[model samples]
Target: MGEDIGLWGVPLAIIGGAIRVSTPFLFVSLGECLTERSGRINLGLEGTLVFGAMSAYAIAYETGSPWLGVLAAMIAGTIFGLLHGWICSLPKVNDIAIGIALMLFGMGLAFFFGKSFIQPVAPDLPAISFGFWSDYPQVQAALKVNILFLIGIAASLGLWWMLRNTKIGLRIRVVGDSTDAARAMGLRPNVVKLLSTAAGGAFAGVGGAYLSLYYPGSWNEGISSGQGLMAVALVIFARWNPIYCFWAALLFGGAGALGPALQSVGVTQGYYLFYAAPYVLTLVVMIFTSSAAKTMTGAPAELSITK
Candidate 1:
């Protein structure tokens, strides 16, 4: 059956890989969207992600429950986010600089703590199999979806609705777009930014948990491979919209899957080059979205990147 599929399998495999690979992008981008929406940028999510992955793996290994591990990761992410938010709120401190420092700090902490868990096997998150009728094992494997992806989808929708409908969301948008305006309205811009940054970290941490507990399903120093950082460019491309973030993440996932899908069909030539697809796509997105003379549409007025 696999042989019969022939070259047709490439696209199928890509589709499967897209579903698998897009989860982390989906999460980190969405989280950044939240942070940027509040007039702050968090470059340290990479560290938060790695740390989350390590902690999730460790907790899950010790507790025998992946969900507990996920919770722990979220808490850890919140702490990291809070730290970033607090430090950035200090006078003369740069958000980007603090983020970079935190990223390194988070990664260092993760590595120091995660060394022992490199050899330990932890419980993995379960997937929902949607390809029950598939005759091919590859198809079945491709159809198996993780629960976190679904949660991310819901989060996107919920975030979109909140941003448009809720009072708190209005405050966040207000603070992000203009701190002075937020102050005029009696909103505490710093507090809003702090909470939003922390919330963003929580989301990034979940993305990391998904990495370690599900797809690629392991804890290691090399697990992230810059997905956390690339997500910043993705947020720019997504125009800070949660819905757009979802689609963009899937697009990135498809691009990332291309090389692997080709290799599955014995197309090993230039396979290493194909791995660069996501990074290339990120550059393309950044180039097309950015304008030196004009601020990006839908961008917060207070956002440093757009300035």
Candidate 2:
């Protein structure tokens, strides 16, 4: 009985760690969900996220308001998205290649701008307390949840509802399913994809903002460790569903924290391997969820990757 109880503690700790660390991934994955649902992919979201983080940190340091930093990050993200969208809309420009280019550009821009602002002090976002009811200190610590996590959950629900129950959602799906069909229905496919990609970029940007302004509260080249790229993979695994993206992001987040968690428990032998857990899980999930045959059977027929 004692051994079983001790083993159960690990799962609970992982869940808590997941919630703590998964917020950035959740925002980015949800953003990718919207972009991919419109039959486009924005690999530049990696750049958007890093730049947003730097922008948020800089803005918050200057303004002394974390919320203001968040708003600035969104605006910056929108601009980045717009750039990607505009470039991709041009004929003879492959969106995938363009996305890669934008990503490199964005990363370079972030590192350049972030150099001068590395040590600036900024206001941090406040956490909402729900642990007052807990008697044990460990329980209270475990239950300390951030308001951003709640916001992420609410955003996921809202996105899911919009995609499933709105006319705009229908248009987006139609455009993704078949551009010819959308044209027949009098909808502009390019316009829809552009808007979706822009919106997704904004969301990803905000996710990046959260990292710099709230989680770490400083800027550096190592601020974002491929959360943006993993988020792209997460969208595929979630099948372009915002709600599923939330869960998948959380799972990845937990995987990310496993190394630190093990270190906390004094087990540091395979720390690097633990750090790779999220990527490994992502590859395995992608293989299982996105086989060529399965895609042919169920994916949106017009999706370029599937085709």
Candidate 3:
């Protein structure tokens, strides 16, 4: 470890850390992008993310299968989305308020039910090594990429493509841009938003799976560190573009890795401050994207926040 830390430490750690940390951001933002495109905001996704982590870890511990745990998390997230959607569809309900309530509820439930999983050993997901091409052990370890990360990349690209070309994507965009137009076209805006929100929740659940089943590789209440909420801001910064979300995830991941990367390079002092890198980046993004006119340039017309 000491030998590897001399000159290559920060870069190597950043590379490895970026891959590990960016994954959840990638997933959550993508999920939020999908939901927002349908004109609903599921702030409850934070709760969905936490609940998914608890469910994933617990199920993985009990079933001895990490993938099964991931599936369970997805299902749980979908349920949360369904509930949020149902409530939001009712007259005069606030999606933002509903999201906050669900976030607290999910956190409470995760802490209550995840007690047994605190000490249990859950299975880990697989990784593909690109480090074999290198001779160093640390290099090999650092270059070992989690399969889920790769899947996130694929999902980002696929989502971007679908939004530009697919029929389902067109419907979602239409509902987002104008409810009246959708109704005129004989499309059900509520149904579209509901299903999109559910899909968003499922993606967040997979992100939770990546948390426990891969990096950090354990079940814990504080594992998410507000990634789900931060993702909402990330989606905004990316202008609700799925392709941009991918790049934004990478940038956030690199910020998150800054502290550890510096520590690895013998910069032990104030290392803890680096953990705030992502949050700092988030603040900066929000500031630059904010407008004095109280307008969101790229936002969908039907979104309550934009109105």
Candidate 4:
């Protein structure tokens, strides 16, 4: 009976873990998708994410409101995005280089200021119970869903619809395809890229907030664990589609949860190696999808990686 329960527990744990782990990925990838759709890449989102986490944690601790912390994170992310966009718009500036620099800068700021927040307790985001009908404690715990995850799902659908139907989406698509064409059509490419990057940063910031204010709920320097960087690969795997990003995030999340899920079932041999599953999957996806011979399918025409 115990073995049977363990077997059943494994799948349930993975399912629950996927939902919990995927929230940040979902937000970051969705943000990256939006930024790329406008023909700009902001690699500095890693920094933005860390800084946002710090900011969210600090604010939540001080204000006693997790929602305010989220708002602060968004604002901070927007500022970082604006800075990245502005710098990239200058003559002879490289967007990729700017992104890397900003990544370092953001992380530095986060570490320096976040030191004080390490020991403080902050208000956590609330979770909605979806397992009310279940009598099992494990099931109930597994089904306790965060509001941010649900919001991410809605954002995915909304982003997909906007990209397919709206005028702003049309502009983003046009800009991403060709700056020359965008200029010919009387659109300001720089402005579009600027706003898109800012928006993307905002999304990433929210992802960071989800990290410290919810799952793994704490303010810490290492909380991100390179998830922000991995989100870039996720965008590639999703082919810049917001809907696909949602699924891809969940896949990555499930992979991340594999180790813990197995451990719970008494499979401890090589347990630590399971933690590498997400990274391994990232590398595999990159290897198969990347090619020097041709542009990736669905990649933005003007994207630096594609070009």
Candidate 5:
């Protein structure tokens, strides 16, 4: 009975970890998909994520509502996106360099504003329960999922549908494929890129909010651990598809949980290696997905990196 219980617990723990950890990746990767689809990249998303976390934490602490914190984070993210879009649209300013600069700026801003908010407890988000049918403790633990995970799934499906079936989606793809063609077709490529980048920033910001308000529930200097950057890599591995982003996020989440799960099971040696698992997996995925021949065909033509 004990062995059966232990064996069953592993899968359940992995599921719970997926729900707990994947929410941010889902938001950021989906957002990055939108930006990349419009032939632009926003490396500043790291900054956006951190700033969003800080802004969400502050607002939620002040307003006494976690939802309001999320709203504020979105607004802040939108503003950051707009700023990034406006700046990147300029002549001779490399988008990648601009992204890096904006990341530094955003991080600075977050640190400055978050200085006074070190210890306040923000309102917590409510978790959804689906454990009613599970009599086993392991089953109940696994079935307890975050509401954001469901939201992320719905958002991915909605984005996938819109990108494949909607007119705006078509326009965005066209712009990403060839700016010259977009201009010839009487579509403003710059406008499309700007809007998409802003939207991406908003998503990244919300991802940040999820980290501070939901998962970790606190703010500090090192709150984000490269999840924003990894989401960018994940987007490529996901082939710029929102639905794939959902699956990729869950996979990364599981990889992240592996270390802690091992620790929980009384296996603590090589903890550092386990901590590196997600990044290692990300690197492996990127190497496989970003082959010279494959990316030339798969990547949007107007995109500067893949080109």
Candidate 6:
């Protein structure tokens, strides 16, 4: 197996893995970006993602439609978001603490309710096969792209455009930048944040949908592996730009693919090292972006860390 692939197979494996893995990261980061840009943070997203995964899988199993599962996940995520937003909007509640609590809550809900879903044969999301150009089975398989991947890319571009040119985008920016300014303009910061958080949670849910209905295509306790939490750091690394989030997601996805990619080419000696690529890259990004001298140059003034 190793000799058949040789050194050339590693890169191709990584590319294929990136396409598969980047979808979740892209959606999660975009969700976090939207919430953060509205001057709020929801660390509960990890739980949200897990719950979303469970919901999507269960619904798909029941309905025989992957798209319906996606919808269910988004709805589940919105409920989680509303809970987080409502609590955090109170006079003295800490968003981080609430987020942690919600994370645990979300996880608990998924675990308890999802027990029946384990091992069920759920409907899987369809992929777009670009593999027809290749005669080799490996090449053809590697080129199979999921429909959600393309949607994620388009969504990122749309987010960037909306944030730069729309009225609602302007409000989100202003509220995120300065609460007092928003209040002066007679806008309710809490209301805006509530909506943004819900929207963010929905996006995270969609990411979770990709996990179960598309990629690994299953429901289990250990499905996430911190992809949701990692996206928070990703938001910072991308400097909160939606377009940059897309590229950053692909990069992270590529890093995550390192170990599997090498293994595809029969190089398994350092498998764990390659698997650690994403975490290492995350730490490096945090270190570089952590300069106090910069005063968080691109950060919103009302952001939790900033305030």
Supply every candidate's count of residue pairs whose N, Cα or C atoms clash at under 3 angstroms.
Answer: 0, 0, 0, 0, 0, 0
Worst 10 residues of 6 by lDDT: 1-10
Per-residue lDDT of 63-115 in model 4, one digit per residue for the tens?
99999999999999999999999999999998899999999999999999999
Ranking by lDDT: 4, 1, 3, 6, 5, 2
- Model 5 local distance difference test score: 0.85
Which candidate tops lDDT? 4
Error of 2 at 28 (Å): 0.9
The sequence of per-residue lDDT tens digits that candidate 2 reaches over residues 14-126 is: 76678877888998888878887888878889999999998888888888898888888888889998899888889998878988999899999999988988976888877
For candidate 6, give the lDDT: 0.89
Q: Of 4 and 5, which scores higher on lDDT?
A: 4
Q: Distance from true position, residue 78, model 5, in Å?
A: 0.8
lDDT of 6 by residue, 140-195 (tens): 66788999999999999999998889999999999999999999999999999999
**Candidate 1 error regions (>4 Å):** 1-4, 293-295
Model 1 quality (TM-score): 0.97
Which stretches in model 6 have alpha-carbon errors above 4 Å?
1-5
Give lDDT: candidate 1, residue 164. Answer: 95
Flag the better candidate by lDDT, 5 or 6.
6
Please tell me which model should have the higher lDDT, number 2 or number 4.
Answer: 4
**TM-score, predicted candidate 5 vs. hidden true structure:** 0.95
| TM-scores of all candidate predictions against the true structure | 0.97, 0.93, 0.97, 0.97, 0.95, 0.97
What's the alpha carbon RMSD for model 5? 1.9
Can you give the lDDT of residue 14 in candidate 3? Answer: 89
